[model samples]
Target: MIDPDLPLDEQNARLRAILGALMDRAERGQLPSRPMGQLSDVVALEQQVRARTRDLAEALDKLRVTNARLSQAERDAVGARNTLADALEAMGEGFAMFDARDRLTLWNSQFCAALPDIRDQLGTGLPFQDYVRMVSESAAIDLSGPAERDAWAAQRLQSHRRRNVNFVVPLVQDNWLQVSEQRMNSGGTAVIQTDVTAMVRTERLEREKLLDEQAQMVRATLDHIDQAVLIFDAKARLAGWNRRLREIFAPPSALLASGTPFTQLLNDLMRRRLLGRGNIRQVLTDWVNGPASRPPLGLDLVQEDGTELHLSAQAMPDRGFVISFTDLTRERRAIAEMHRMNETLEARVQARTVELEAARDAAERANASKSRFVASASHDLLQPLNAAKLFLASLAAMDNAPAQSRLIGRVQSAFASVEDILAALLDLSKFDIGAARARVDTVPLGPLFARLRDEFQPMADRRGLQLRVMPCAASVRSDPVYLKRILQNLVSNALRYTERGRVLLGARRHGSALRLEVWDTGPGIPPDKQTEIFREFTRLNPSGEAGMGLGLAIVEQACALLGHGLDLRSEPGRGTVFSVTLPQASAGPHAAPPLPDSDQTAGLLSDMLVLVIENDATSRRAIMGMLEDWGASPIEAASLTEAEVQIADLGLAPDVILADHQLDDGATGLQAIAALRAAHGDIPALLVTADHGPALAEQAERAGVLVMTKPLALRRLRRVLQQVPQLRAGQGNSAPGARRGDHSYWLRAGD
Candidate 1:
């Protein structure tokens, strides 16, 4: 087959080459098969052999690359182990890692140093028990005793066998360590021993600093507080005391400082007698055992040394208590003084009230007495004057010659002056004593001015001056009688003093008031004496026949009573003008009733029957004479009994009755009137009184009798006569009675 056709040497060489090729193939991991018989074929086989050799070389190169990678992996493993050991050494906690057998496999220098005495002895492969045993014997693990060390090691060893364990361990030199162990999945353990000495010391220092700050703050605040303060701890130790307490108690500084026992402080106080120790000790005991918050306890005590103290104590929520001491000596003394002053003032006020009551009673009695005296005097004096006035009028009625009538008129004028002076004095006294209560009424200025004009026109004619009264339709709010009196006085004064020129009585509208003015062209009041003219008894022209200066004063008082304003304007050598501002009112039928005209004598007086009841004998005679002059039949009685007899037995049915207000035998003129009316009929009557007071007016009004004051002209009687109707004795409509003195039916003031 080696190609028989070739030489045997070639066949043999071919076979040896084939064997060499097979050996090369086997060396290069190539399998050899049977060869082909040809040299070129052998060359092809050589080419195939070269290709297999190249593939084998590529596989060898890949295997060499894998070997280099394995070497690099081994180097990396060594580097990683170094890095792990360095990390473990750099850790804050001691590191000790054990294998599943509980023998130490890895550890750092810190782990060995954690047991300072056994540092050289600690290493890998040490059982956890031996390590704990070594640590237990060192000065680092200073347990309570050998028994405690053994127990702690036993308990730690038991914990080490578990999957996890964590605990703190104390060491020598105040050092502390927290030991923790975490079991791995391979049954190995990682133990961490953290040296927590710095953390524990830092926390303790911070706590001490906070406590110091709080204590300082408490002390500073308590020092500034006004009251003395003392604080006790939960153990009843004197934990805090302010500067004020030290000053107040005067105790030794050391005894008052913090950590001082409360019992000791109380004992010191008891020795010093600053407190009743019994009370303080009882309260302290209560505070220590009591439940929760309650009202603070308080005590006020006056010490033996004159120091007054107000003490209060409150129990803290979680601790002992706080106590305060306040001095109250000043407050106590002030309260005592105030009480004393109140007592004194009460006594004084009681005394003053008593005195005031006595004085008021005396004043009331005096006023009543004065009123009685004034009324009595006025009545007694007017009786004589009334008699004289009527007698003079009877003389004048005789148709005497001019000279005789002139002398009679002069005497009458003097009598009139006396009457006016008395009237002025009475009015002044009433005003001064506040006895004249005004009876206010609506006064129509028309009627009022008419009266004033009629009243002063004669005086104006006598003085050779014209009197012109301006007509006013305006009505006013005033007491008509008082208002008329005021104007009468003013006009009389004006006409008396005014010797020439005209005297004008007029009214003008002034705002809501009517200014009733009296203007005269006589000598005006001097500027200096204008205000003086209104005072009592200040006569400006005593020789010239001016009044006793009471006219304007009466004007002033009357204006005051009506609350009207009076103003006077004057210039020396000129005329004076007096204006009264009268409050204007609604004008209608509300004006005051007009007074009867004394000048008119219209009734038939001769046929009329009249009875005269006068208290004074002279007044009765005078009244009877005036009625006789008027030609009226008059019956006379001086007392109530006499008047009663004249009315009953005499069967007198008088057309008119003239009664005096103050009658004899404790009977008033009104009583006489009432008695006569009972026997006779409802007869018209007139009450004549010396005083025009509220009592007499009210009595007259109640009796349905007209009122007239004393010392009046006979013309007033004539005017009264006109009011009575003619009733003759033969008419016989009623019971017949005695008639007055024989007289005609009518008579004027001059008749």
Candidate 2:
């Protein structure tokens, strides 16, 4: 057998010798007794042994190559370690590396040089947290003081686990280190520490110099200001003061020095009486010992010599307070002198005011008397005017020659002028005496516009002017009578002044009001004369015009009474626009306007009986005559008593009763109507009066009696008489023995 552990050459020689013997034995066939199979077996066994030896030789060769490569790698590793050690030693900054397990793997000599006490504790295989703990516990290092050591260690370890971090740490002897940490791809942390002590010292020196300069500037500014100033530290000790404080208080040098307690200084001032008497000392003491945060305090101090001083104290962000004192002596003295002088002047003015008040009272009384006279005169004038108007209307209704007709027409025109002047005077008096009242209603503009067009169309045709009134869809909140009169005066003024151009009456919607504007294309009023035109008896052209220039005056007063806003816009060569603004109202049924004036009174009052009770003889006769001309059977009486006698004794149940408001025996037409309705039935009655007061109208409305202000319109009178039976029927009342007829309805007076 070959020995496997023997040298390769020796083993090969042994194998060769064994193989040679076996082969010779097999080739000689010496032993005839041995079988050929056994000989073949020996030969095969030698072949297997040789194959095993060859495989062993190849394995030895491959092992030798692997051992040579491993030896070379080990040598390279030793050299790289030496190079890393040299590089770390040569670096300017201290460097350290922690492995993935957070164990200190490598560090340079300068890593803990600033803190030599911890140098021995830092080594390979030491945990990163333990290294940080040793450094934080080191006596040589100052982590902003000893109190922050434990916190610094915690922050250091936390930063070591982050990707990148940078911070500065201070050491004893004013040294500082800038530490930077970076994370490696192998999940290890690398820390680099740089000494920044020189740069930190340089910046600190510059900062101290700047602070010195600022302190000097503050000291200079405090000394120059007029107010005395003192600054206290957070501990309430005297920290700073200005020259003015020393001069004002005049305290001893020792008491005013720095480091003195605020209480000590305050007690010295109080003892010397330099500070004002009162609670000033106690207040200062409590404020000094109070909480760090306090509200600002201010007080005025009057000195013994009458010198005034204002003291103000406010707290700062550092829990200190700054106190200031300002002298107010000169200003106080000047104010006192001015107050004395004002008292003297006020005494003189009081005497004068008493005299002026007496004069004003007397003037007001005189004005009131004038208003009464004007009112009485207008009422008395209207009575006779009403008679003449009625009589003239009756005469005009009869057939006459053309020459007589023209003269009657002139007379009617003159009467119309007188009527307008009287009406304006009455309205002016009502406003002057404060007797006008606005009965506001939801007055629709549709019917009002229709009436205005009918009244002005003839005048417009005669003057060859276009008088256009736009259709209105809005309603307004105002007195129906006063509002219509205001618009009428405005329209009349516009047409009269406009020679050959058109006049426009329209309504424009403003926010909550409707602006009723009367626009005219005529010779406009000048800016200066515009105000003058609204004054009574003032006209631009008084020659050819029939008006007494009271149109605009009446409009102004009516608008004022109704509480409507009025505005006028006019230029010399351009047109004019007069706008009246009234509040808009919701849609509602309004009292219908008066029927259009017509001469056709033929069948309206034919065979209709009307009882006329008027006090004025001429007025009663004229009204009775006019009623007769309208084909109505009229009965005349002088008073309500006479009419009652006619109805009771004569058994005259008239279709309608027309009575005067101011009747004989202090009996108003309203009372008369009430008496007749009680005795007879709810007879349709009309009250005619020259007094257009709101009291009479309200009384008439309650009594269900219609009121008509004189001088009355004849056409209106005839129309009203025609519809009296219908009005009576609508009331569900008819006089006994009265005729019933189907007649068109007419709106009652004061509707």
Candidate 3:
């Protein structure tokens, strides 16, 4: 069992030492080795030595195998523990373990990471509650309650069994961490912390965003709407309102104040209530709920400041009611205007209806008057003609006697007056029936004045008054005969009215107009009676006048016919001047030149020819005689056809033609003149009518023809004839001779 290859010195030393010890013992051992008995003792000792060596070797081998098995078991246990620690450190949750004394026994890396501030205390095994108290106190987290401490301890103790805990702890970043606990057999507590910061932050942000959007939506919707909107709390306190409500109820000062009481605001509103009819409370309630269950309430509100508003209200249960007010002042004004317009229309309609009825009544009266006039005229004609016949027969019976001649002259004169009246009446009828026409021609004023001078000179001499014709170079487009008639009537009236005064007939140009003036230094017309003088049948001086009051009326009518206006200026004792305005002719040398004698007979006619057309035998004869006396040849025709024939057959080409408007064949002289002028050239023509109608005169003037009423004075006839150059001067190489005649010689037959 022992190695036998030992060194000899070592073996020898060992034997010697043993022997020496044996001898020392056998002083006690030497005597026994030399005998048979000495052999037995040596073998026994050797065997004991071998046995001891073998037992020592066997003990060493067993001790070496036991030590190897114990080392292998310790290494396997260390590897398993390292794997468990790596698993705990990989978790997101903070993990820690504490002992039954609440001291930290074991803690993973995550626990130290989660609470870095307490990492130095981990190995010290501090109580879990103390660690929580330290975190609460130092980090500003609250963890003071017993329940919280117990809960934390329990969470640590049961950390492995639970996924999360009921209570969470918040960190400085506003992040939340869920905690769980478990208890270990080692009387330690385990804690797990899980981060839930993102979930909690998202939830909170969502709530805030929703509130902000809601507030913005409410503000935008209320502010832009036309109606007023109010929001109130459950206590009926005002919380918010739109701009419309603020404008209606709150002044700028009050709205800007910090905090105004709802009750006080309501009281102020009631004091300034726009509706006066209802109590404030009742009105507010009605506005909130409407009049009927579903019907709206409409009211016209008049504020204390006199502002009118139309209001409509709608209610919301929790949000209060919205009231809309619209100013209606302009609408009320429009309504008033409409009312006035309606009243005006009604008044106009009533006035028009009344005027129509009045016009109808006037027409009926006029018809009655016409019938009466016809009957009276028929009766009057019978008496005058019968008396004339009787006188004529008696004169015939007394022929050859000198007394018979005088009787015949008186009879003739009486019959002539009657005939003139009848003729005037007939002419008036023709004018009324619109049968009158005009023959228009150019009329010179120079010659017209000359003839007037010759005729009125004698009359003026007899009356011891000066009669003058002022110089003028003016011609007009008008009816020459009618213009002469108008002048004759005016001059005659002047002579009749004045006892002794000079009468001057002159014309002056006013701009493009000519004013024919007849001025007399005699008794003037009363201002109040001047207008009446131009009316038919109106007279200012009636005594010693033996004709109807129609002279001035005819003059006025003639002025109107010629498109001329008449103006009168007078004073009671001074004199009267009557002016007739006519359009002036274009200025030229050939247009009615002024006469050579500027002072004496300045407006006299030097050379002119005239043709006289008359229907009545006596009138034609008288006109021809007057024209001849004025040194003017006069061609006569009884009818328009006869005049036309005479004008054509004579080939005389007279400067002026005078014709009776009412011819024998019911043909107007205007038709005859038109026919003659068409065949020849435009010649001056005059129409003689007994018509006194204003409309007839106007028609004659409109046709450029002159109209003269019946019973014409010879002087006026001569003046009109002299106004025509071609008529006064015969159609010859030389001018005709001028003849001087007494004004009385040219006097009308009746005069």
| Candidate 2 C-alpha error for residue 161, in Å | 99
Can you give the lDDT of residue 270 in candidate 3?
A: 66
lDDT of 3 by residue, 190-266 (tens): 67767777876774575355335535545654675455555544344556667776766564456423244445555
lDDT of 1 by residue, 212-289 (tens): 653564466467656888888777787777878877678876696778877788778777888743476666557555
- Candidate 1 residue-wise lDDT at 21: 73
Model 2, 423: alpha-carbon shift in Å? 0.6
Residue-by-residue lDDT tens digits, candidate 2, 707-733: 788999766666667666666666633
Show the lowest summed lDDT stretch of 10 residues, model 2: 736-745
* TM-score, every prediction: 0.46, 0.50, 0.33
Candidate 1 ranges beyond 4 A from true positions: 1-376, 399-403, 541-543, 587-603, 648-652, 726-751
Q: How much lDDT does each candidate structure score?
A: 0.71, 0.77, 0.59
Query: Which whole-number lDDT from 0 to 100 does residue 723 have in model 2?
Result: 68
Which whole-number lDDT from 0 to 100 does residue 337 have in model 2? 55
- Top candidate by TM-score: 2
Q: By TM-score, how accurate is candidate 1?
A: 0.46
- Could you tell me how far off, in angstroms, the CA of residue 597 lies in candidate 2 after the best superposition? 5.4
